[model samples]
Each structure stands twice: as structure tokens, then as C-alpha cells.
Target: MKPEKLSDIKKELAGRTVQELTEICLRIAKYKKENKELLNYLLFDSDDPLLFSEKVKTFLEEDFKAMQKHYYHSTKSLRKILRIMNRYAKYTGNKQVEVEFSLWFCTNFLHYADLNTSHKPLQAIFIRQLEKISRLLPKLHEDLQFDYQGEFETLLHKADSQARWVSKSLYL
Candidate 1:
């Protein structure tokens, strides 16, 4: 069955009382893991976006380090990392945070993985993230967009260079 349009859903929700809306939210959260995660973020983690992004950054750094040092599952690990980053972006619902997260992911991926050109899937994931960064840049404030654009350019150039500069230091 086709779902109702967003406007219709908004109208229906607008008519609901506070307790009724809370009940509906709780019921929805019970049915899906993602829904539950989003609800938790809204309820508890939405106060300080900078703090949330920093937490995500720290998590990403740790995961990337672990993958680099121990995990041999290249494509699988990269996909998992990207999925987590995307999920965090969804939680914040902020374009700036999304862009920052994407930038950090790309930076860390380049530094840690230096993705072998022969690995098509891994390369595709990197390219897809760059595309996401490009898409998100325009949605940011003009000054922020200009700043991120510089970083994005650096990443693009790094991707273009055939030479792989894998950092000897494992921790980024």
C-alpha cells in the first residue's frame, strides 16, 4: 500500500494530543531498530550537535584503526564504516554535520586505507562519499561551503594522484 504524503502525515500528526503523539512515537520506535535509534537521538543526544559529531569522529577513528591493524575484510569493513557514518548523519539531521562527517570519513579512509585501485567496490564507496560531500556542500552556509570546498578539493586531488601515501602511523 502507498503511504500517505508527508503533508498529510503532518496534518494528521498536528491534530494529535501530546500524549497521543508520544504513544505513537514509542510504538513506532518499538518496531524498527533505526526508528528506535533516531528516537533516542532526538530524546537524549540532540542537545549538543558538536559533541555528537565529536563522539562519532572518535568512534570512526577507533574503527578505522582497528580495521587497518587487524581486519582483513576490506570491502565489508569499509561498507560498515560508511553505514555507521550515514546513520550518525541521519540522527543529527544537519547538513553541516553530514558534510563534516563525510569529510572526516574521506580523510580517514584516504589516510588509513589508501584504497587499492584494483578493489572496485572499495573505490566505489570512496567515490560515493565524495559525491555525498559534493551534494552536501551546497546545502551548508556560504562561508562554511567555501571552507569545505577547499577540503573537498584536497580530497579530490588525493584521489586523483596515483601515488598512495599510506601513513606509517596507524592512529589518525
Candidate 2:
């Protein structure tokens, strides 16, 4: 079945009392993980997006630390971690959080999963995510875009400079 449009949903919800809305939201959250995560963010984490992003980063770091070091396993594990991070980013639907999460992913990928460059598929995955982060940057407010642009530029430069080094070290 087709879902109702967001505007229609908003109009209907506008007439709801606080308790009614809470009950409806709780019922929705009962059946879907994404719904629950979104509700949790709106209720508790929305007040401090930076903290939420940092918490996600910590989770990413832990996942990275637990990853198998073999190149084949590393690529698969990185993809899984990135998928989880993207889900958290979607729960917020916040551009700043997206950029921050992407930056954190890139940093962790480069530092802990340097072997990404050793395999063409892994390198392509890294580049694709960089492209996605670039796309997201333009969607932020002008001030935030400018600030994040600087960070992306630095990341791009590092990725480019490290490519050759990563290739050379492939046999080590």
C-alpha cells in the first residue's frame, strides 16, 4: 500500500494532543527498528547532534578495531560498518550529521583499513563514499557548506597523496 504523504501526515498529527501523539509514535516504534531509532533521536539525541555523531563515531571505531585484518575481510567489514553508519545518519535526516559521519568513516577507513587501496573493488568503494560525501556537502546551509568544504578538501588531498603510498606498500 502507498503511504500517506508527509504533509498529510503532518496535518493529521497537528490535531493530535501530546499524549495522543506520544501513543501513536510509540505504537509505530513498536514494529520497526528505524521508527524506534528515529523516535529515540527526536526524543533524546536531537538536542545535541554533535554528541550523537560522536557516539556513532565511537561505535564505528569500535567496529573497526574488532575487524579482521586480512584484506578480503577488511573490505567486507568496512562496507558493513558504513551501512550501519548510514542508517544512523538517516535517522537524524540532518545534513551536518551526514557530513560528520562521512568524514569519520573516511578517516577510519584510511587509518585502519589502508588496504582498501590494495584492492580495486575496495578502492572503488572508498571513492564512491567520497563522491557521496561531496554530494551531501552542497545540501547543507551556506555557512555549514563552507566549513565542511574545507574539511572535505583536506580529506581529498590526503586520499590522493596516500593512494601511491598505499599501492607501494601493498606487498609489505
Candidate 3:
């Protein structure tokens, strides 16, 4: 069976009593981890998007410290970290959180993993995040964009100075 449209779902939900709605939500949360996570965020973390993002960053920092330095594991770890970050960002419906968290991720990724191993996939993942930042920057508020741009440029400079693979020109 096909899923109902969001508008139709909303209309149906609007007709329900509060108790019924709560029961429905609990039932939905029982079926999927993402639904439960979204409920948790809405109930506990939605008040402070910045705090939620910071929590995610701290979790990522720990993951980075634990990451294996080998190229294969490192790439796998990066993908996992991004998956976690993206999930949190998706809950907030905020571009700034996504952009800021990604920048922090890329910078930490550079410091946590050695770049001179001639692993193109690792380098490409790094560049892909920079490209994501470029795409997202224009969508954020002007003041935040300015601040993140400075950090972005500084990140690019650090990358350029430290590795031949990360070119500042292509991203900016």
C-alpha cells in the first residue's frame, strides 16, 4: 500500500484527540529508530539547536579519537560520523547546524588522520565536505555566512599549506 500524503496525514491527525495522538506517536516510534530519535529530539533537544549540535560535535570528537589511522578504517569512520551528524541536522531542519558541524568535522578529520599516505578516497571525502560547505554557505544568514566563511577560508588555507591535494581555489 502507498503512504498517505503529508497533508492528508496532517488532516487526519488534526482530527485526533491528544491522547489518541500521543498513542499514535508512541506506536510510530516503536517501529523505527529514526522515528524514536526524532521524537527524542523534539521532546528534549529541540529547544536548543546549538546545544544539540555541540553535543553531536563532542560525540564526533570522541569517535575521531578512537578512529583507526589506517586509510580504509578512517574512511569508514568518516562516513559513520557524517551519518550521525546528518541525522541530527535533519532533525533540526537547520542549514547552519549542518554547515557548522561539517566544518568542525572536516577540521578534526584533518588533525585526527595523517594525509600524506597517498589515499585519494580520504582526500576526496575531505574535498566533498568542503564542496558541501560551499553549496550550503549561500543558504545561511549573512552574518553566520561571514563567520563561517572566515573559518572556511582558514580551513582551506590550513589544508592547502599542509597537503597538495586540497586546493583552496576549487572550493572558494
Candidate 4:
């Protein structure tokens, strides 16, 4: 699959309303699920490893495209949130928490994506880094609402620890 043109997606999203963008996000999620299913089939069911590898590579490319589309749609909501925060900050005279939240949100989202897409061996490393960042997020400010923080931290630590054990077990 050809790489998605970021500029084209940005242009398309720029003209769409919030409702339309949400609809597009749903469609993109559906497409991503379909792509993942196809990849799983190619990876696990094919007799020819070479052919399967090629198909998997193609599937990954398509998956990335879908991810780009979803990210583009999400950017619309993120921008709106940032705009509202900016306005609120201006009136309230407190921009630090809002800015920190925006930074944490963006970084966490990208790290989550990277962790999901990384190879099994490297996934643990990313997850560990994400966990560290997640911990720092709460320290950034007290005003930030980190809903499900406990659940996420637990999951991240579990994933990283399991992956590390697996890697070490293989080595031993």
C-alpha cells in the first residue's frame, strides 16, 4: 500500500465538521480492524512463508494508512479541545495545566500507537518508556484529570514485565 499523503488528509479534514469527522473516525476504525484481520490470516494460515511475509508487509502498510486517517480525524477534536483550553486559560489566568495536559495527551497517544505497532521484542521497551511518562503525567499538575490512571499504569507495568521475562527466558 502506498503511504498516505498527510497534506491531503489534513486538507480533507480541514473542510469537515465535527460530526463528519467523528463519522470518518468510525469508518477508519472499521477499516483498521479489517486490515488487522487480514494480516492475522496471512501470518498464521499461509503455507508459503515468503508469500506470507510479503502479504504481511503489505497489510502493515495499509494499516499505517488507516492509522494516519484516524489520527487526522482525531486531530480535529484535539484542536478544538486546545482552542477551548486556550480561551479558558486566557480568562482564568492559568495556562500551565492546560498546556501540560495537551503535551501529555499528545505524547501518550503517540507512545500508545508506537507500543501497539512495535515488534514483540521492542514492544516492552516502548511500554516501559510509556509507563515512565504516564507516571510523570500526574506530577505535571494536580488539575489534570487522569481518569483510569491506575488501570493504565497496571497494564503498562504488566506488559513491560511480561515482555522482559519472555525475552530473558528466550536468552536463557
Model 2, CA-based lDDT: 0.81
| Predicted candidate 2 versus true structure: per-residue lDDT over 1-172, tens digit per residue | 9999999999999999999998998999999988898898889999898899998888778889988877788889988998889999887778899889888888778778764346876786777778788788889999998888888777777776766533322211
Candidate 3, residue 147: the lDDT equals 95
Report lDDT (Cα) of residue 114, candidate 4: 37
Clashing residue pairs, backbone N/CA/C < 3 A, model 3: none
| Model 1 RMSD vs true structure | 5.4
> lDDT (0-100) at residue 113 of candidate 2?
76
Summarize candidate 1's per-residue lDDT along 123-152 as a digit string, tens digits.
Answer: 667767777877888888999988988888
Could you estimate the TM-score for every candidate? 0.78, 0.82, 0.97, 0.23
Off by over 4 Å in 1: 68-72, 114-117, 157-172
Per-residue lDDT for 92-158 in model 3, tens only? 9999899988899889977997788689888878988999999999999999999999999999999
Q: Which candidate model has the greater TM-score, 3 or 4? A: 3
Indicate the residue-level lDDT of 49 in model 1: 77
Decoy 4 TM-score against native = 0.23
Deviation in Å, model 1, residue 141 alpha carbon: 1.7
Kindly indicate the candidate among 1 and 4 with the higher lDDT: 1
CA lDDT of each candidate?
0.78, 0.81, 0.91, 0.44
lDDT for model 1 comes to: 0.78
Off by over 4 Å in 4: 1-69, 107-172
